[model samples]
Target: MPISDDIKLGHAERLLAQLRESYLQDLPNHCGEIENLVLSFDRKDPETVFDEIFRHVHSIKGSAGTHGLHLISGICHHFEDHLKTLDGRFEKIDGRFINVCLAYIDCIRTAVSLFEKGGETLPLENELEQLRKRFLKNNLAGLLVSSSNYITMLCQQTMGDLPVKLTTVDDGFAALERLLQQKYDFIITDKELKQLNGVALTLAVRASDSVNRDTNIIMLTSKMSIDFPAGLAPDEILPKNTGLSHALVDAVGKIFNGK
Candidate 1:
């Protein structure tokens, strides 16, 4: 006798629900650790930082697979390949390269968030392809510039000719302060900065006014581990090594739709 398809569908839904809950409970902490590693990259000893970053990437690759985020997992796997090439060598981390990596993280975080919200499609494939191209380039600044352009293009695509105000802050603290004084629908930041760092800044904002408490926060970083503070929960955390334009656009859509 053929089994009932209805029963099978119900079972699948239950299993997916269980996995979603588990991921929600554990993802924040894992991402926080990665943020810490990203922030410490400039200040820590080169050998230690390299090992920490490598481990962070490896962990993300493993966890993403467990959560069924195959695109994110694949991206992490490719990034790990690059990191492994520099294992034991004391190479100075390039700022441009770091920026590109952060963009990728932002994309993954946004995509995962959308999935959790019942979104049926992912939007950042083109940006990811562009990032893969930049990954082959040795010039760090060029990569950063390319990513910036990609982000701008993404915003235009999602919003349809609407201009988004773009401002660069020196660090997370400044960015947080600016956010508090304004009515921004969304805020994006790197995990590491000269002051406060992204996680701390997020915590500070959430603890402030009631209106800002639920504001969307997206963090970008190249670190692999995710270890954020308890009170400083961000809406999303992205790995610095992926293309994030689609993720950014999706976040904007959610905000505009009042989700």
Candidate 2:
């Protein structure tokens, strides 16, 4: 049976929302960890560096899948495969290899930014495919859930009465795009997302046609020193360690009442 376009869009929105929430809630630390690993790779031992890179890419691939960034996850899968092939080989880690790795990181960064921007069609599909075929020949395709999944699950459990949609994504721009198409009373985000980050996402939402016209936004962050990004201000920023539920409810109420 042909699926209704409405249903498809609705499902896509819900999924995207979940992804946005997931990445916003996590990803920062993950990206940081990968960056650290890359920097820590042994310059004298290409094999050791390959191993380190493999682990970092594997972790990213796993997290990307869990958060529903299938494209990002797929790209990481390919990168990981490339590292695996060089496991036992004593090849020099040339500038070209570094460039490819940097490109992958750039892609991941772009993907993260896109999610906060409300999601956009990615342009790295061909590169991702080529890298995947070249690197992950023996790898099996599968999904991996991330910690953000648990956060969203908690949100759903707690806000059962509110008609809220949650999504996970590799790009905040894409999430913003999805959010603009719908009428959401409130938007909740975390500080640690990949590309756009929480502050960026909030600003993007506020600047968006629907959100800028009028949409309540609440930012959740583990950091205590989060500041509003330039040209973007959120309605509120709540500490993740504090009373998250209370802050969210209060923010929503204030926005709804024009306070």
Using lDDT as the measure, the top candidate is 1
Question: What digit string (tens of lDDT, one per residue) describes model 2 on residues 155-191?
Answer: 5454555433233344565555445433334566666
Candidate 1 C-alpha lDDT tens digits along 1-259: 8879999999999998797678756665666676676667678896787677778777876776676776666566545544554546656466764675566566666656766786744355556556655654422111011124444354345444323433345565545544543334466766666657766777788888733566677776677476766766777776655456666656655654663
The lDDT per prediction is 0.59, 0.57
| TM-scores of the candidates in the order shown | 0.44, 0.39
Q: How far is candidate 2 from the true structure (C-alpha RMSD, Å)?
A: 19.4
The TM-score measured for candidate 1 stands at 0.44
- Mark the 10 consecutive residues where model 2 has the least summed lDDT: 138-147
What candidate 1 gets wrong by more than 4 Å, as runs, is 1-16, 120-122, 138-259
CA RMSD, predictions in order:
19.0, 19.4
Q: How well does candidate 2 score on lDDT at residue 27?
A: 63
